[model samples]
Target: MLHTSLYCRSFPSPSHLRSLVLSSRLFPSVAVRTSPTLSLRRSRANRSIAMAATEDNRIKRIASSIRVIPDWPKPGVMFQDITTLLLDPLAFKDSIDLFVERYKDKGITVVAGVEARGFIFGPPIALAIGAKFVPMRKPNKLPGEVISEEYSLEYGTDVMEMHVGAVQSGDRVLVIDDLIATGGTLCAAIRLLERVGAEVVESACVIELPELKGRERLGDRPLFVLIKAKGV
Candidate 1:
C-alpha cells in the first residue's frame, strides 16, 4: 500500500526553535545553564579588563601633558617640563591622585620631598594621606641642626640637608621627587631618612630616565614612577 504520510517527518516550529529548555536529553548541549557560577566569573573578568583599560588611558593622558624642551639647560638634552602638565587642571590632579591612591593605606607616617619640584607634588600628597611633610632641602636651605648627605652627580657632587628630628625612629617614610636622572638625589634622600632610623617605605617620582640606569643605584628600594621617558 502506498502511504504518503510514511515518507514525511515532523519539523520544529518557530517557537520551539527559539525556546530555551531547562533540561532536554534530546538536545542536552543546547539546554539552558542551571548554574550561575560561570556567568558570575565572566562578568568579573569583563570588569577587570575595563578597569585595566581605564588605568592605561589615565597614564597616557598624564604622560602627554608634560612638555619636552630640547637643549634647555644644555645642548642635546630633552628636558621633560611638568610645568605644562601643571597648566592642565585634569592632568595635575590625576598625577596627584595616582600617587595618593597607592600610599593612602600604606601607613606612611612622613612624606619626605626632595627640594624644588618635589615641594610642588609632596605637600598635597602628604596632606591627602594624613602624613607629615618633611622637606629634604639643599645645603644651607634648612635651619636649625640639619643633617646633610653628599651624593654624587653626573659631573661632580651635591649636598642635601634635612632638619633634625624631622623623621624619628620607626617612622615609615616615602620619598618624593619630580624626576630621577642618575639617582643621586633619591639615594641621598634615602640615606638621610635611614640615618634618622626612619624606614624608607619607597620612593615616588613623576618621571624616570631608564637609559641612565638610575634604578640600578636605587638598589632594593621600590620606586613607583608614573612615566618612563628619556630626558637626554
Candidate 2:
C-alpha cells in the first residue's frame, strides 16, 4: 500500500482577487513587487539628490576660483576678477559646462555675448551647442552695418552694437555675460536682440550681485547664474 501526505493550499477570496485585478490595472508597473517598486523609486530619488549636490559643489568650486579685489578701480568698490578662473583649467571648464548643460536643450539658435567678458564665455558655449555666436560690441568695433542700443552709465550714456544680419526674426537667443552689476549692459543687449526681432530666451551670468537688483531690471525675461555673490 502507498500513502500520500494531504496538504492544504489557500487561494484568494473572490473580493481579494477582484481587488488585486483592480490594483494591477491601476498600477501595472508596480504590480510585480510593491517593495521593489518603492525601493527603485527611492534609488532614483537618491541619484537625483546626489546629482544636485554634485552640481552645487561644482558651482561652489567655480565661484571660489574668482578672486575679489578691493578698491582697485576705485575706493569703496569690490571687483570680482575672473582672470584667476581662466588660469585654472578645471574651473574654466566647469563654468562652460554649467552654461552648456543649461542651454543645450533650450532651442537657442544664437548666443549673443556682451562686449569683452561675454566673448570669453560665449564662444565655448556656442560651439558646444552648435549655435551661432554674435558679438555685442562697443561703437565702431564691428566693421559691418549694425544696430546700437544706448544705456546710461554712472555719469553718461554708452552704446552696444550688434551686426544687422547676425540675428534674424524668430531666432531664439541666449545673452551671456560674466557679471551683472548695474544691469545696464545686459538690458542693452536684450533691447538690441529684441529690436532685431529675435526672442531673448534668457540671460546668463557666472556671478550675480543680488544687491544690485540686476534681475529686477530684466523684467519678464529669465536669468540664470551659477553663483550669487554677497557683499559685492
Candidate 3:
C-alpha cells in the first residue's frame, strides 16, 4: 500500500488537466467517453479506431526523433537509438508525459526500472505520481543483499538483480524501459517483482519491436508502449 502522505498532493491544475485530457483524446481506445445511447461494444470499436489514428500520428513524431542504425552491434541488426530522442526536449517530454498521464492515478505504489534506459524514464514518473522508485539493476550493481533472476538473451543468458528491501509485499508496481526487443529483460524484472509479492500493474516502454513478438512472451501481464516500429 502507498503511504497516506503520498496521497495529500493536489491533482494536476486546470491547464495541466486539459493537457492530460488532450493526451487521452489522442489515445481514444484507452479513454472512450461514456455515452448513454451507445452500446459498450460500439463505443469500444469507435475508440479503437480513434486510438489507431491517434497512435499513428504520435508514432510519427516519436519515430522521427529516433535514429536507426543498420547493423551496428552486429550484422543484420537495426538499432533504434533513443539518444536522438533525448536530444529533442519536446519529444523526450512527450514520451515521459504520456506515461505520467496514464499512470498518475493508477494506484501504482512503485516504479521498477530496468537497468540503464529504464533509469532515465522511470524516476520522472515515480516523482510525478508520488510513487517510490526502485532500480532493477545488473548483477552486483546494487550494494546490498539482492535477489537475481537469470533471463535468456539472443546468444546467452544474463542476470538482473534488485535490492532485497526495495519493494514491499503487495506494492503495485509499473515496470519501465526505453524499448522492448526480445522481452527477456522486462520478463526478468516482472519475475523479480512478483517473486517478492508485488503486484505488477503493467510494463511500459517508449518503443516496441513487434516483429520480435515480445508481447506474446508476457503472458497475462499488460504491456503499454507508445511506438511500434515494424522494421527498425
Against the reference, the lDDT scores of all candidates come to 0.89, 0.88, 0.87
Clashes of each: 0, 0, 0
Task: TM-score each candidate.
Answer: 0.83, 0.83, 0.76
* Model 3 agreement with the true structure over 39-79: per-residue lDDT tens digits: 78898899999977865666677779999989888887788
Which residues of candidate 3, in runs, are more than 4 Å off? 1-58
- Which lDDT tens digits does candidate 2 get at residues 21-140? 566655354243469788999999999999899898888889889999988788877888999999989989999998999999989999999989999999999999999999999999
Rank list by TM-score: 2, 1, 3
Residue pair clashes in candidate 1: none
Better of 2 and 3 by lDDT: 2
- Where does candidate 1 stray beyond 4 Å? 1-43
How big is the positional error of residue 207 in model 1, measured in Å on the Cα after superposition? Answer: 0.6
